[model samples]
Structures are given as structure tokens and as C-alpha cells.
Target: MSARIGVVTFPGSLDDRDAARAVRLAGGEPVALWHADDDLGGVDAVVLPGGFSYGDYLRCGAIARFSPVMTEVVDAARGGMPVLGICNGFQILCEAHLLPGALIRNDHQRFVCRDQQLRVVNDATAWTTDLTAGQVITIPLKNGEGGFVADEETLDRLEGEGQVVFRYEGLNPNGSLRDIAGVTNERGNVVGLMPHPEHAVEPGFGPDRAGAPRSGTDGLGLFTSAVRSLVSA
Candidate 1:
């Protein structure tokens, strides 16, 4: 059976189409979901694309966290449904408590835009199963408030339990605590990060790499990993 991956579209979402395209490119059927709608359309997995949801009012993802669709998303995620969140979507996952840590303003107080290198810290998660631990991948990262913060105890727990899925390699762009770039839930079914993986899935249009032609597809592993997990499940 073909895997169906849903990409949610909030009012201010800017990357829903890109996420859907990534899903399609990864050999999964892309289902467009609305924030106000409760239906998931029976997708096997879901992706919350990056965007300025609710105008980033109140707080990033604060308002979208309460959207009607998120109610189902939260429940489904708890039930082991695969969920991936990027950028603002990562913020929503935190607000919903599906993932730990909160995104704070960048230490530099500027919207940083560049291709960032990230190391796969944990390849056991559903969304990162295609990658090998310690493998470095470059992806486009652009955001103003991307720093991740959490209590010391929570940080320790996450690290001890192998929940940290990705870590910033080389230079830390946002001063995220412990150089954490992404994390997965305890169940390993939910993953969230600030980098825009959807933007790096396609070749020629993705971030450039040295000495490698058409090498910009490093982020395609994320989408492929999710599809592989659904198939095995």
C-alpha cells in the first residue's frame, strides 16, 4: 500500500506546499490538511511545515497549538503516529508538549539564513531511520527565534534517553542549548526541528555542497525515513 503523508496548512503557513512536494518526492501520497479541520484524512504520517502561524502572535505556534486539527494531532502522536515538525511546526510541537524544549529568540537577535550542517545524533527515530548516527547533512535553516531551551533535568533526560535526534555541527547558528538541532519524543514517533528539511529535499534547488554535483538532496533522508517506517509498521 502507498503511504499517505499529511502536510498541515495553517493560516500563515509558508511551506505547506514545499512539504507536500517533499512527501510526493519521497514516494508517499501527500495529503493537504487544514488547521481548522479535525480530519487527518487517514494519513499514515503528518508533517507540520514551517511558517509564521497566527502571525507568531502571543508566541510562535502558541495560537496554532490550539487549532482544532492539533487536538487530533496530539492524540494521534501519543498513539504512536509518526509526526514531524519543522521550524514553526517545531514550535507547535513544543507548545503541544509532544516534544520538549521551547524555541527562544536567537541569541544574536537576528533572523539567520544559511545552510547549516547537522549531525544525526540518533538514527533510531522513525523520521531518522534512514540516516546513520553521526552522519552529517546540510540543510537550509532560516529563522529568528530558533534557540531551544529546557530545564536542566529535562535536558539531561532527553540526552540520556537518546532523544536528541540531530545536533548542530561545526557552528551553532542560534545558540540552541547544548547545540541541539532536533529531538524526538520518548516513543521516537514524534520529531521536531528548526531547520527546513523540506527546502533541502530537491536537487538543484537545495543548498549547495562542495565537490559534489547534485548533492543538495541531503534532507531527502528525512522524508524517506518516514515512508520506510510506515511501510515496516
Candidate 2:
């Protein structure tokens, strides 16, 4: 049976469709989940796509943390369901306290959109089983306020516990603390990242590439990992 992955759409969300398409491309069923719905439609995994939620009022994802759908998302995540949050979703995850640290304005004070190189730091998570630790991949990243920051203690803890899932390989686009691009919860089920993996799952349409491994589909591993994880579970 195909594993169904839910793609959540909040008000002002623009990449939900992209996330769903990525799930479909990964050989999984895609389920649409609205931000106001209290149910997850029994989807095995969840993807919160990148976009400006609730118009990014006050702070990105701050208001979205209280959305009706989050109640179920939180419970399901705590129960060990895999959840991947991207960009604005990352901010929401942080605001909800599901993931430590907060995303603030970019240190450069500008929206950065580029094909960013990211190194996989922890591939044992439910959503990263297909990747190899320390492997570098290029994915699309776009955000205005994507800098991630937390106390020194928390950063050390995340690093020591292998919760830092991805880090900037070449350059830090938003000046995130320690060049962190993504992180995972203690259970390794919940993950949040600033880059848009969904945008890099397709060839010829993803980030522009040059030579070998030029298909621009490096991000496909993330969705496949979740699908395979659920199928095997």
C-alpha cells in the first residue's frame, strides 16, 4: 500500500501544492490538509511547506502556531509521526516549541533566494534515512527571515545529541547560527529546515545544475526516506 503524506496549507501558504507534488513524485499518496482542520486524514507523514503564513504578521509563523490544525499535528508528532517543516513551517515549528530555537531576520537584512549547498549532519531521522551523513546536496532556499538562533546551551545540546540535521556546506545564506540549515526533535521524528527540498525534487525544473549529478533531484531523498520509513514501519 502506498504511504499517504499530508501537505498542510495555511492561509498565505503558497508551496503546499509543491509539497504535495513532491510526495506524489516520491511514490506516495498526497493528502491535502487545511490549516483550520482538526484532522490529519490519517496521513502517515506530514509536510509543512514554505510560504508566508498569515502574512508573516508580527513574526513568521508566530500566529500559525495557534492554528486549529496544529493541535493535531503536535499530538501526532509527539506520538512519533514524521513531520517535516520547511521555511515558514520551520518558524512555526519553533514558535510552537516543537523544535528549539527561533528564526529571526536575516543578518544581511535581505531576502535570499538561491541554490544552497547543505551538508547532512544526521541521516538517522525518519525523514532523512535515505541520505548519508556528511553528504552535501544543493537545494533551493528562499526566505526573508531565516536566521536561526538559540542560547549557547541549546546549540551545544543539539550538536551533541545529533539533532542538527543539516548545515550550510559552503556559505550561510541567512547567517543562521553556526550555519545551521535544519534541525530535528529529540525523537528524530519532527524536522524543520529553512531550505525548500520540495523545490529541488524534480529535474530540469529544480535548481540549475552543470555536470554529473546534474539532474537537480538531490532533494528527492527526503520524501522517499519518509515513504520508505512508513512502509517499513
Candidate 3:
């Protein structure tokens, strides 16, 4: 059977449908999960897509972290289930303590939106197995609070342990420390990033590339990597 990936939709979510479509395009069954629902429907993997959950009240993802569904997600994540968080979802992951560090407002105090280049720093994680180390890919990035911050020790530990999964390639867009763009938990099952990879999975709707109109599809590897990981397991 094909891998079944669940995409959770919290109130104010703007990318659940896009995430589901990306899962479908990646040959996985897309299961719709709700924030208030405690059940995960036995999905092989889960994706928390980008958006302003709870309208970013009291900080981004602060309210969504307490949703009923998050309890199950937290348990499953600790048990080694693959979980990927994007943009606001990344904030949620940190708030729930599933991942370390935090995302604060951009240093420039402005929302950023553009095509971003990232280098895959670690490809052994559930969400990046399809890529190779040092491989660079372009995807869309849009966020107000995208800056990743952590203490010196945590940052050093992440680098030393190879938990820093992705890094900004050319220019750091949000003043993230060490140009960090994404990270994975120690188990590598839970990963979070501030970019919107789901938006770049489809060719015609993705960012434009050199000499190829709307040909950027680097983000597809993330979904496909999860499917491969589930299938192989």
C-alpha cells in the first residue's frame, strides 16, 4: 500500500490543501486531519503546513500548540513517527517542545516573501532522505517571524550533531543564526523549516528557474523522502 501522510489543518491555515496536493503528487494518500481532532487516523507520517494559526495571537503558534490534536502528535512524534513542520508549523513544534530553539520576528521587522535558496545540510532525516548533502534547492519563503534563535550551546550542539538539516544558501533572509533554515530532532523523525516547500512541488505553480519557466520542483523531494522512508521501514 502507498504511504499515507496526514496534513493537519488548524484554523487560519492557508496551505493545508497545497500540502495535501503535494502528498498526492508524491504518490502518497493524503489524509486530512483537524486540529481539534485527537485521532491521527493511523497515518504513516504527518505534515504541519505553513500559516498564521490562531492569527498569531500571543505569538505565532502559541494557541495552536494547545489544540487537542497536538497531544497525539506529540506522543506519536516522541514514539518516532515522522513529522514535518513548515513556517508557522515550525513555531508550533518549538512551542510544543518537540523541537528545540524558537522563531522570533525578523530582524528587519518586515515580512519577507521570495524565492529562497537552501542547501541540504543533512539528508538522513525522514523529510530529506531523497536529497544529498550540500545539495542546493530553491523554494518559496514567506513569513513574518522566520528568524531562528537559540542559545550558543544549542546552536553548537545542532551543528556538532548534524541536526541542522538545511541552511540558507546565498543570503540569509531573516537573520537566522548561522544561516539556519531548517532543523531535525535528535531522532531525525521530526523536522521543521520556515519555508513553504509544498508550494514548490508542482512545476507550473512553482518558482521560476534559470532558462526553465516555472520549473522549480526541488521541494518535491521532501514529500517523496517521507514516502520512501515509510515504505522502507
Candidate 4:
């Protein structure tokens, strides 16, 4: 049976459907999960898609962190179920303490929207197993508070433990510390990133490459990776 991946929808989520579509494109079943519901409906994995959750009030994901559904997500994530958080979802993971560090406002003090290039520094995460270390990929990224920050010790631990999964390839769009674009938990089952991979999973509708119009699909591997990992497990 294909893996069932749950996509959470908060009050202000804008990419829940996109994430679900990406899952379907990757050969998995997409299950809709609600913020108010305290259950995950027995999904094999979960994705918190990018969006201005809770209207980005009181700090990006701070309000959404307390949502009833998050309690179930947190518990499931800790139990080793794969979880991928994107953009505002990354903020939620940090606020929920599912991942270390926080995403602060950009150093430029402005919202950013671009096709971001990232290097896969660690391909061991459940959502990145299809990537090769040092490989570069491009995806769409848009966020206001996307800079990742943490204490010196935590940074060191993440770097040393191979938890820094993705890094900005060249330009640090949001000035994230150490150019970190994504990270994973110690167990590598849970990951959070500022880029929207779901936005780039389809050809002719994703980011462009080599002057081609909306032809890039580098982001598809992330979803396929998770599906393959589940299948193998």
C-alpha cells in the first residue's frame, strides 16, 4: 500500500493543498489533517506546509504551536514518525520544541520571495534520502521570518551531528545563521526547512531552470524520498 502522508492545515495555511498534491505526485496518499483535531488519523508521515499560520500573529508560529493538533503531531514526531516542516511550518516546529533553534526576521528586515538554491549536506533524513550529499537543488522560498538562529552550542551540535541537512548554495536570502536552509532532529526522522519543496514538485508549474519556463522539479525528490523510506521500512 502507498504511504499515507498527513498534511496539516492551520487557520492561515496557504499551502496545505499544494503539499497534498506533492504527496500524491510522489506516489503517496495525502490525508487532510486539521489544526483543531487532536488526532492524526493514523497517517504514516506528516507535513506542515508553508504558510502564515495563525496570521503570523504574536510571532510566526507561536500561536499555532498551541493548536490542539500540534499535541498529536509532537507526540507522533517524537515516536519516530517522519515529519517535514516548511517555511512557517519550520517556525512551528521550533516553537513546538520538536526541533531546536528559532526562525527570526530576515537580516534585511523585509519579506523575501525567490527561487533558492540549496546544497544537500545531509541525505540521511527521512525526507531527504533521495538526495546526495553536496548535491545542489533549487526550490521556491518565500517568507518574512526565515532566518535560523540558535546558541553557539546548539549550532555546534547540529553541525557535528550532521543535522544540518540543507544550506544556501550561494546567496543567503534571509541571512540564516551558517547559511542553514534546513535541519533535522537527532534521530533524522523530523526535518524543518524554510523552502517550499511542494511548490517545485511538478514540471511546467514549478521554478524555472536554464531559461526554461517553470520546468524545474528538483523538489520532487524530497517527497519521493520519504515514500521510498517508508516503503523500505
TM-score of each: 0.98, 0.98, 0.98, 0.97
Which regions of candidate 4 fall more than 4 Å away from where they truly are? 211-214
Q: Compared with the true structure, what per-residue lDDT tens digits does model 4 show for residues 1-233? A: 78999999999999999999999999999999999998899999999988889899999999999999999999999999999999989999999999999999999999999999999999989999888999988999998899999999999999999999999998999989999999999999999999999999888777788865446788999999999988778
Instruction: State the lDDT of candidate 1 residue by residue for 138-212, as single tens digits.
Output: 999999999999999999999999999999999999999999999999999999999988988877888889876
In candidate 4, which residue pairs get closer than 3 Å at backbone N, Cα or C atoms, i.e. clash? none
Task: Kindly report which residue stretches of model 2 are placed more than 4 angstroms away from their true locations once superposed.
Answer: none
For model 2, how does the per-residue alpha-carbon lDDT over 1-233 read when each residue is reduced to its tens digit?
A: 89999999999998999999999998999999999999999999899888999999999999999999999999999999999999999999999999999999999999998999999999999889999998988899999999999999999999999999999988999889999999999999999999999988888888766883657888889999999989888
lDDT of 4: 0.93
Q: Which residue pairs in candidate 2 have backbone atoms (N, alpha carbon, C) closer than 3 angstroms, thus clashing?
A: none
In order, candidate lDDTs are 0.94, 0.93, 0.94, 0.93
Question: Comparing candidate 1 with candidate 4, which one achieves the higher TM-score?
Answer: 1
Question: What TM-score does candidate 2 get on C-alpha atoms?
Answer: 0.98
TM-score of 3: 0.98
Clashes of 2: 0
Q: Which lDDT value does model 4 have at 186?
A: 96
Task: Report the C-alpha displacement of residue 125, candidate 4, in angstroms.
Answer: 0.7
Judge candidate 1 against the unseen true structure and give its global Cα lDDT, from 0 to 1.
0.94
